[model samples]
Target: MSTQTTQTTQPMRTTQTWRLDQRIRVTGGEVAARVLGEGPPVVLVHGTPAWSYLWRDVAPLLARRHTVYVWDLLGFGDSRTDPGAAPSIARQARTLAELVAHWDLDAPALVGHDIGGGTVIRAHLVEHVPASHIALVDAAVLGPWNTPFTEHQQQHADVYRTMPPDIFGDLVAARFRTATHRALTPESAAAYLAPWAGSEGQRRWLDQVAAVSFEDTREAVARLGEISVPTLVLWGEQDQWIPLSTGERLAAAIPGARTATVPDAGHFVAEDNPADTAAALLRFLA
Candidate 1:
């Protein structure tokens, strides 16, 4: 693999400032995405409570050499979902399959983070989406992936769904804070918080949380050995949500898969340490 590294001196742009205006109709709804750069194609997927903005810093770096495609999953970010639509892992995977087809990409490199990782894996294995390379960054591919917050939300969905917008925003912000090792700047925090600011956003957020299930991930785990593409399992060394050991095991399970860890980052590695995260991806994709 290539060991090249990229350095940037430009001021870091906040996720709030990142805009994805392109919309594509998928299975259930329209997904917001943006394509950048040239060369070979790459698709980046983000996890729960996060939109493509999660890749605001990392995508630009990768776009320097690769055509980067970033999208917000159905029901998240600027994406539109049908009323009462649940953005489950399985459903998202199907959408991903359709997206790959829509993009008409031929064996493009795929990168996913958190639940996005689950979506990518399921799309490749279950949906039979082909990729030249696959990278999972702090992915939730193992069983018992749900947190106490998710468990409680799943059990009492109605309660959270009706939570006042201010309270719900506070709750979401608190949860998001825990995903990173370092403090997020006010601008960065606002960018993440923007999607879940209103009643509709709150309902969509709860719907996604309620849709979280271990079954989808368990199915992917059972088929890990069946993966044919080059795989890279990347994790945040300080991930409090899913420990690094899980990533190590995931890498070990996939035949010939490699592993890399980003130090000083938690579950949200991209936001906490985008430089190293992007570098790791560049090195692998090279």
Candidate 2:
């Protein structure tokens, strides 16, 4: 594994060991990305409302054995973006595809969570991004992904955008807490909530919420069999966002794909069970 002498930084409100940080240009703006280790490439992609911080624990450990690259999706984390733009799954997937080419990661393994899982799949199916392997953890690729809350936000986007900072902060914090089987520590909660804590952040939060759409996912789900790379589907047994049954269906849909469950975990399996998640990934990568 590689090491940098620079002190750890808190760009997204957490201790990150990743270095070689740079802004890679994409469609609308640049996306923040970092690379670690020096072996076969492994890309960690996160979904909405989260940045590369989602894989803080898993990245370094994986880096010990392989090159690990993590990045924040456009409009989230330290990545520059347009606050007025609505979220588009196709756009995020295109960004991921472009990054893979820009990084020159030939046949890199992709591990994605939440909408990230969908992003990688869309990149493979629609954008034809070459991937050696894919692992979906509590992914939103299967269907019926948009929740009532997300639907309401899309419906009342104007009102949600004007919500008070404190009110929006509290609402997001509450939702993130319930995302995991275990309670998030105050520090961790604050770190995850940091991005959307201020006035400007509140507006971005509304934009992020309004951007949520399942239309692209619906299209990708229908073509799951088209993916030829080896794939693994990992899900939190107790995930409230995307259920275990969805994981099972996903595994079955993909050719020769296998499924596993992280016990006592919710949608945020890495946060709840990093060790098990890492172990599962190591086995698949091997």
Candidate 3:
């Protein structure tokens, strides 16, 4: 495993500034990560088509009371983009476990969104990674998690893989728009889009989409009852991709799991309502 550090500034659209200044080599590839604040460790994992930038608003809030670590999953953000690297949920879970060991974190609280939800779950349950607490935000835990857009891209990978860069970027932006109840600021949109621009970015984006499979979640869902750590199932009341019902089911499956809902938010609850999301997390983590 190799490590690198680079100081780069992201365009400040909001008060939060996301800088992926640290890179750590993991099983799949080097993952870009940022560490901030000081206290108990809290790792924020982002979902599909998004990198650590997704936590720009929420990480700082959580960092105020906890040592927060945010990292881009392999093949996303500034991480190594080897087309051969498989960013499958199962592989991502293992990569996360590897990160936990590399950081020497003992049972850090985990917050995950979208496919990231699935990653944390699998890492804890299947990979036997320990965590003091787990929070699932609009997670893709239940099976049949694919949306029409993802299905289309999965079925027509070749077409999307070779689509014009401009068109592909627009498509990604449109997907991001749908993920939130409110529109993303131009700067926020650009930050999210930066990782998926150009030919290589387009192919890497499609590769992750194509790698999506229910089998990964199916394995974890079947073993949900085995989750011993305190769990929080949080959802966006307006989530269109994964309904609130899935979140409810997930909460029910985990023993003593608490539930929280962010109104007027879509799948990306952090982006939609970071305040409520952070508050719910703070309460649970405390």
Top-lDDT candidate index: 1
- Deviation from native of the Cα of residue 232 in model 3, angstroms: 0.4
User: In model 2, where is the ten-residue run with the lowest total lDDT?
Assistant: 1-10
Worst 10 contiguous positions by lDDT, candidate 3: 7-16
Displacement of the residue 228 alpha carbon in candidate 3, Å: 1.3
Please report how far candidate 2 places residue 103 from its true position, in Å. 0.6
Clashes of 3: 0
* Root-mean-square deviation of every model: 6.2, 3.8, 2.4
Tell me each candidate's TM-score: 0.93, 0.92, 0.93
From the highest lDDT down, the ranking of the candidates is 1, 3, 2
Instruction: List per-prediction Cα lDDT, in the order shown.
Output: 0.87, 0.81, 0.85
Predictions ranked by TM-score, top down? Answer: 3, 1, 2
Cα lDDT over the full model 2: 0.81
Model 3, residue 71: what's the lDDT? 89
Question: Model 2, 32-90: lDDT tens per residue?
Answer: 78888878899998886777777877888898899988888877877766544455777
TM-score computed on alpha carbons, candidate 2 = 0.92
Q: Can you write out model 3's per-residue Cα lDDT over 192-249, one digit (the tens) per residue?
A: 7877778877878888898889899898899998888898999999998898898898
Clashes (N, CA, C under 3 Å) per candidate: 0, 1, 0
lDDT of 1 by residue, 171-269 (tens): 999998998999988888888888788897787788788787989878888999999889999999889888899898889989999999999999999
